[model samples]
Target: MPFVLYAPVKDGLHDPSIAKQVTAFLSKLFQDDTTPGLHIEPINNAVDPKVRTGRVTQMYRAVLFKLVSDGVPHYVFTGVWPHDKAIEVASKAVLKMNPVNGLPELIMASEVDLTPVVERVARVPVASVAAEFPFLEYKSPGLTLAGLTEELGLDPDVAEHAWVATSEDEVMELAGKLGGWRGEALLELAVGATIADVRISLGMDTAPTVEAEAVEDEQLVSAMRTPTAQMQFAWLEDQEELRRVIEGGDLAAWRIFLHPEQRKYVEAAYGGSFRLSGGAGTGKTVVLLHRARMLAKRNPQARILLTTYTRNLADGMKRSLRDLDPSLVLADAPGKPGIYVAGVDQAASQVLGSASRDELAAAVEAVLGIGGNRATSRTSSAQKAWRDAIESVGGDLGPELRSPTFFDAEYDSVVLAQHITTLDEFLRVRRPGRGVALGRLQRQAVWEVIRSYRSSAAVAGAVDFGEVCAIAAQLAASGPIADHVLVDEGQDLTPPRWQFLRAVVPEGPDDLFVAEDSQQRIYGQRVVLGRHGIKIVGRSRRLTLNYRTTAQVLRFATSVLAGENFVDLDDEATDDTGYRSARSGPVPIRVATGSITEELDRAAAQLAEWLAAGAARDGIGILVRDQRMVERVARGLEDRDVRVRQVSKSAATGKDPQLMTMHRAKGMEFTHVLIFGANADLLPAAYLLKDLPEEERADLLQRERSLFYVAATRARDELVVMWEGKASDFLDAFTAKDHVR
Candidate 1:
């Protein structure tokens, strides 16, 4: 009855069988530590007298450290290992309390030998060593060894080891060797985090006040309770919770352990709407899922709506929410009093689906200035409608204004965005982010085109999804649908979608929460949230710690947007800076072949090699530019006797090396990725760029780059990019770096 058990979420619990055994052991231990089946025994000659080993199975044992806090026994389950190895680890490892931060840290008695570094340094000339020493600058001022150890609480020995690192890669390797807070601290410092920044990121700045001279166990237990320490250590609440944590293994670790920076946003109480922005894999969506659950738990009756750009991603978030807490009640409709998950359009449809015919007609009149039932209308694509309007009524317009791209954008960016109905209103509205200027005569021509499109849509009773969203916003104004709305991939939402979301949820405390990354904006153009009545001024935060991709892959992915600029929802210039990955892997490999056939052959060989090296077939992806390229590459792989599947709407459900378009690759990650058709013409996709104005053309290029960035970052461990003839101009960013393989 006096037991408090904690477990460190380590990386080795991937085996389902071992996970089950560990789960069973934890259940028995938590229920009663005295259970003989646990075989909980003290390790002989352990460095720390508290160290012990408990039997998890016949062959495996759980290494634990037992401490007493206020007359209660507390155990820390370090990891699961084989019988002999577990004993060895328990005897040599000690859970030490960090003196400066007053937090507990896991340490090993054995230290990495610097003999290899010394020998390598000895072989190099003094000048060469000075040039190659990655951390030589650390010897100066605030970044010195003493500064890291005495000030930041990094283990002195680990700091000394990193001081001798010859390259950045060596420092990363050393960090891996000295795992735990020390490794993370070193990694943070190496990635340009200042000493104070490291403290803040580690949550030490906000940690509970600790008595340095307090009883050792009491201090340890207190440290274990800090948000920073919980990133690696957590207590088991019940057998079911323990089972979820262990059985979910490394893949599900995000649900259990959250970075201190992430935890702040997930639990913070906002007075109004807040925006969370980050790069790919920075855990924005993770924060949304956690925050949704936290909000639901706080008020069981609160109607929380969780929505995203596409139905597929919304569906995925629903599953993730369920995984985080199966007890959560998910609602089938946005108006229901529970956490509702659906795509933005789907949410709009749900609202409109229940509206009366008169309400629907009024909503349509409000949006398009036309009275009709949009549900019964023959829906047409926005592009086709724009083309038909341009060809029929935009004849007098200049060659520049005659483009469907320009007209379609004008309608979204100015017309629907501002709810402009009449030509006079359209001419008066300010057009922000519409690069090309329009004179009075040109504006009149554009209005004529818009009028033509509106007339045709009215006669045919056709409405685009954008109009539906606008209509939903109008209908919801009379009665809001949700008490709270959480949006993911907010960057991809059109202005109409933003208005609909704003209308669905009343403007108040915790009304709207958005998770987006402008750098991953693959669908819609830049939208200023304030223009849509959503104010996040001084209420926005960014995440820079990428938890998904490796540092090398992150570097490669970010380079694609090197010169491009982006703006946030606030309309201020935003940048992709301060991001750093905790892990490091091989630099991406890029190859240029003579023809499409040769490129396919190279991709096939690499895919085959990964499969041969034991990578799971389902864990590898072949991403191409378009669906056509997806089919083509799939056929190429099939021709080579390589079994493959083409996936859309969702990630591959089965094995056999799936292929998909770059757009489909968003919100997914793979252990290995092969971008098979990255040629210059195919990437910018000549068809999309032809006959476009220079500024509009440049905008398309940015979207293309973002698409490539998404595909490149989807790779978790390794990435291989192949092209026929000349590679895409995006590859030029790769050649500038030493990572070109």
Candidate 2:
């Protein structure tokens, strides 16, 4: 294992130019790599006597371990800290190298107490579970500390940590807090999780450790030498990649490190449709982009379509894909493509011809058998529009029949999205989540409104966007033009959109690769994928580790979705279990102010604090609920002499810290995010709750909460949630959980 100096630590060096010093040292140390040239000097009173220190500058120190690994001298740079902190880190007397990942970590020798495990070793039996409420095992003893250590494949230093603890409770607590694969498995067992096969499923069963007396097999030697994550030590194969990493500083680590979970999905091959779904920030999109590139490299001539639900996200993907590999053929503009990077609507227009709302309006006028200029389509719900169509034709409409919003939900969310065409289909459609009772007569009245609208559209020759996508799907199913189609943010696309995607590429091995998480679906649309001809029963995978956001923010975001259930495209319950983050940061700052002015003042203060802490202006985001606040916040920032920019959906990419709505905040991440004006009425939109029943409004409220969750996760380091005038009711759930009974 050649020592890998992380690129990120360069940013904190006493001198920025110290990166060059470290680079030159690494270049020489890894010159022969196998036989080492020694510059590493021992730090007195180091945690593990084997660990040594390397010089970066006067103020910064590098803690590394030089060991004869797998019969070859290898150097592993474990960490970079300021001089004092570096000494403290090195003073942690024990080093625990993960057998599975081949990464070395340190814990203070004094931190662990082995008396609990050593004393109780024979008295307690650690089985998967006890038959009678497991009470006996919790209070009693388990197997020997040494015996447990051997089964978990832990090294001597790590094993010593448990031997010092005397209580079974302490042993279990250690497992929960331990950071490696070994502890992960032990924690699972302690919690009574039924792991099917430890060796294959969990990867806790690993190669022999260095402290072991004998190398059990010939293969174990090579396995021990190679690190799974590039973030750890690996023989640097490309000097240019190394140089780029050094020059770019910290962000370079993101390009190099692939967590074990992400690596699994990125490198896997399948014989049929495949999907990767998980909680937000779990790196599903990372795998999607990587897998797409891998396939492109394997088949250079193959045509690939990288698609998503929105133009903004698609554009973002295009930028990231270019960064991943610039030479790969990819779409440049919306329709001008080498290989397509497009939104579903854009793709549909490319294949089935574009239809503007105006054209559709004209077509509807023709269907209405009218010759005058077509009436302009006002922004309104589909149900209201249907009602208007009937009224325009002088049709009698009863009171119950006038529930335009409810019927409109039926049409837009169910009918058009599902591509339901016939009256019989409409009658049979079960709107399970509609939250309003509609009897046979009511259904008939709604059907009459829809029927009249469709007839008028037919007479006027109007075709809506739904028909455009249906046609695109039909055309795509006819032949295979693109060799592979990859989708990101698959959660937000409607059913017909998914059908169109399924049709765009002929079903085959490696044909369609999708990454999604239903919990992040801000649009509040759900589609059963199997019904749309996409089968992923055994082909779907969920990633649990979140690498993007801090654990503090992730916990709050997760709690927002707690007690709610979401479905994947295939109608399967989307699982968010085991989703976690290793990075820890400050708890989100929650502010409850009595007025908007006070909320803005507090938010501005927080932003100023973050800016003072060295955050880039663009890395901060102030997400609001609407355009009025967008303007108000911009003026407020101006008043405080903080340069600001208001970013609209039309112009999202910028260097200035952005001010936008939560809806516009999707597909974006910032280091510091301030979400304000999340008052219940504004977030769910007053229109959704105007006349809706409590049951119907509840569903919308959940979406509002989910929208906040998305905004919360955008913060990589810090999140601040603020509301004026008693705070949004959404805070009630978390408050109840946090308060003592």
Candidate 3:
């Protein structure tokens, strides 16, 4: 037999000395027909065909199962086990190739009897959930192998075995045990992926799908090793590398495998524009990055711009790029199309001139008639000048519709965003994004305040932050800068920023690809792409399988925003219809701290439980409303010797429990998340509602809801929502009764 070692077997090589022994024995056998003490004999037919057991140590035995690829036979060491358990492991081992990615993978065949479980399930065929739980669609009684096959891209044999022997719970069990993309595929199905989506994600329908045919034992033995992702057994080419992986115990490879549909988003070419919208943890960013690497590989000479809303996220994206493909060189990472990953501001500055926040603040002060900038407020907050200016009118504009917060959002997000400078232009501008209805007369009155605010800025020779984006967009439209542009967190960018992004990239096939989840848009910056000349009308797709967060956590997180309609980048209503999670965990723990002492004690106790339960110090995360809470909780955890990794301006991924402001937890996931100090005062955030009219306060609360959703979804397994004194009204509303009163 041609000797080979699979990743699974290498991963289980916990002891370096024992691994070296296996290498020595294998090398000796390869040299001749046998080693001094090594004995190889075919296992019984009740287990796998032509399976041989090699003694690794006095107590441990490893299996060498013969699998054929491309009509050649190869002996692969699937895994090692205790000598007594070798027979059991071999009896249930699966040596199969994934039909989706057409990659090979190993799965433990089930040894448990299914007859009892199937009988129990027969009592209750299928328990249907409410309409709110749209994705809970599996009807258990008749859920057949064929039904699951259409969704999981499994081989007929694999699907038949699974359906005949599995229960709903077993689906999740096999998913986790399968490992790699096979596990991911099964997990997606458990979360309610449609057959079409599963097909697309697995790349099963990408082109002509290849289904490996069964090869004879003799034919398989001569076949060369073909190992790629589909959870296949990755064969090492270097002896040193193999030795290091087996002996050094550093076999954690950072390879990202995408679903076929996700692959389609990365590889397909739209005739013009394309956009992808999905809930958080649906792998949108993964698709965006893969698309970037895909384009880079397609043409080494191409330059691609991958931009996000903030520089922090751009930096995060850069780190992910390196992890996904270390060979691809960007401005920082060394290797071709040579990607330029940065915030939208980096590209915006090229067109609008690079003015620091201090400079922008000075200009804003001059425009707002406040003299040449002495305020601590930064340039990004310049949009506040308009609100302060309008509210300066006091009761003159009347109380009925004179809410400064409402007018500010209307003018900043819609008016200035629309680039309307005159009263006539404002009158004719579309107000689709405006939440409150405004008649012409109400708008006329609002315009008077805007007109006065404008005259002050015009006379003082100043400009606000909004004007910067407007000017940048105008400048960019003059000439496109890059051949292709990919945007992450597109939902957070304002209309003007979207326009600028559109202007920077000339329209063409694969020119622009934006991935966003409007439900996670904490900034409340909504846009209709068509308004910015970036049309994604019929070229948009939505992903529904969530890879992070447990099913219980997803249910709770999504429930926070239930019944509310959200708009996608194209301004069409985005439906999270089939969005679901496969992994199950405890429903989030909501601890109401009756007193401040109870609050602190409760949080500390929860952290203790997680640490004791064997969660990685780095895997557990604690999130709070703002930096002040971050300091308080982080120090508290430190007092207990719990290492805390803080996410901030100078954030770095560290091997310790993470503590961060809920805002900083965006696009991040952890095994355990303790949302600390969810008190009423802390939640709406003193800053969120302190300045807004009571009538306009709902929008702020909604923004807080989105922020809460983002933070809650960060937990992959455990979630604890803790509070002191009266809980936030949001917390109450979220856990409200499901049935109609």
Candidate 4:
């Protein structure tokens, strides 16, 4: 026998708990009746025949008739109804199959009979029925009058009329008049009234029309109290479960999932230049990675060019892309046909080097005012004195001036000025009387040497890395490559690089993507790319969720970055649903009143303990404010038998404990981070005050704040920020504000 099961859309097997119970009940029913076949279906919407065609429906109809013709029992499991269109169709189909199988034995299996089919059948009195329905066992008796009305789909006044009645006869009379199984069930279950009272009240054996005036008054009062009634449906259980998931490291359960501002920023799809400025641990790199992945998904054919200031960063990004998607073909070298990743200066030099040496020399001379053979004539006596002074100095001028051949005009005037400045400063500091009193004479002598040297080499001019960018920009602007250019770390671009980008990219609007965080700017002399024609197309999007650190680590880091420019992450707990950290680590910050040696010992001890506790060696990083500090810390660690690898600006060839200057640590992650020398002089030194206007001071401070933010965020499980005696004033602000515990 085949049985069909139907449920109210609102009461269908959507809830897992309810579905489990229904499945169990049907299994038990089938176990006892081996001859009857049961079919279960949900009736949320009618099946569209177009989806399957006539052949499919005919097959089902034919199978059902064969079972009936063979004297096999079949059953339709569904809610009781009075005027159910589905039931009507089923009844007609069954009648055509066999005359003896009439009505298919109607069964009421749900708590409420809101269907209209019951009224068309005889109004069976409750007293006459000996067997109790299965649905009544699941129904709650505590359901309020209003709750019952909603659950049973009845007019409040009509429900109230039957609810107030007392006897079974009256309920049956009312059900008969109402003319439906839905009306019968409403009176029986919701009103708790018997059939006797329903029959007496209506003064008939059939269902009666409900009083319209009474229903209207009841509905008005119900409407006024709807909000309070609706509050009951909020379902605190579901809310508790959701909160548990979020607090248990399932971060995706939080409202908005990603930060709301971040979603808006990404959706804008701003084609022009857009910069995301934040401190180190603020998910800037994550946003960049996600943006790159998103762009690849959107425009698979468009080639992406990612250039960082250093080769390490470029390699890290390339490795990250591979980790993100193994299928994404990445070239080991930058000049590949797909996504190109390389150092910014390397890319500029490669592109510019294609030009002829004479053409390149002309461009360099135009910028630096070198060569052109327009030398100022000097007397023989002055020339003799210049040669005599150079011989007396006894220093190698070629190496100092960066000249390969003595008379080459390719030697830059800037290089000459740098050499003269170094010699002058050396004389002032070490040998005070030699050039101090003879200032103009000293300057004239330096110029005389430069002129004579240029005349010997026959070179017109030379261009350094900066000039290469400018020249390349001009070359790319006129060439076919100008249509698409993608720049990374665009915020740290110098004036020349900006000019170079402007020269290569076409005017009036170009497809440019700039990924940068202003807070990570360690160099005080650089210009933000946006200030030089890299128009910001939309608001900066923040990637607040720290995929790299725990809440405790992020808390201490954010505290250090307290400023107007810092965007705080949503404090909702971590999402630990999919992936979770195995061990909980302590928040890493230490105060040391001892000397530099003591600080290094304490930091190394902590690193050893972290490693002992199962942290990977590659996951450890040591960050310092400058290269001098890096060298000091590296030497100190080596003395203690710690194998420390110093990350050079030029190459990445070492292992952990990777010693990196804070400037180079941007866009990288470490499982355990030890920040050394957070003193005021090193962190926000007086050097940052040089050559800056008053208005730019605030910008510098913000940059400092961002630097600290970045340093703090580098840790995944443990973060140790330590400083010597008398730490930076910035530390006081964070500690006093209880930003770190």
**lDDT score of model 3?**
0.66
lDDT of 2 by residue, 105-161 (tens): 444332355454455654665444543333223433453445445554556655665
Candidate 4 regions exceeding 4 Å error are 1-271, 290-301, 326-336, 369-462, 480-482, 507-510, 525-531, 537-540, 561-588, 649-655, 686-705, 736-741
Candidate achieving the largest TM-score: 1
Clashes of each: 0, 26, 21, 67
Question: Across residues 459-490, which tens digit of lDDT does each residue of candidate 1 receive?
Answer: 87777777778888999999887998999999
- Cα lDDT for residue 351, model 2? 66
Q: What TM-score does model 1 achieve against the real structure?
A: 0.95
Model 4: how far residue 660 lies from native, Å: 2.2
Q: Identify the superior model by lDDT, candidate 1 or candidate 3.
A: 1
Ranking by lDDT: 1, 3, 2, 4
> Which portions of model 3 miss their true places by more than 4 Å?
1-92, 96-105, 109-171, 178-254, 332-337, 350-377, 380-388, 391-395, 399-408, 437-465, 632-646, 651-656, 690-698, 732-741
Between candidates 1 and 4, the one scoring higher on lDDT is: 1
For all candidates in order, the CA lDDT equals: 0.81, 0.63, 0.66, 0.46
Candidate 1 lDDT = 0.81
Q: What TM-score does candidate 2 reach?
A: 0.75
Query: Candidate 1 clash total?
Result: 0
| Whole-model lDDT, model 4 | 0.46
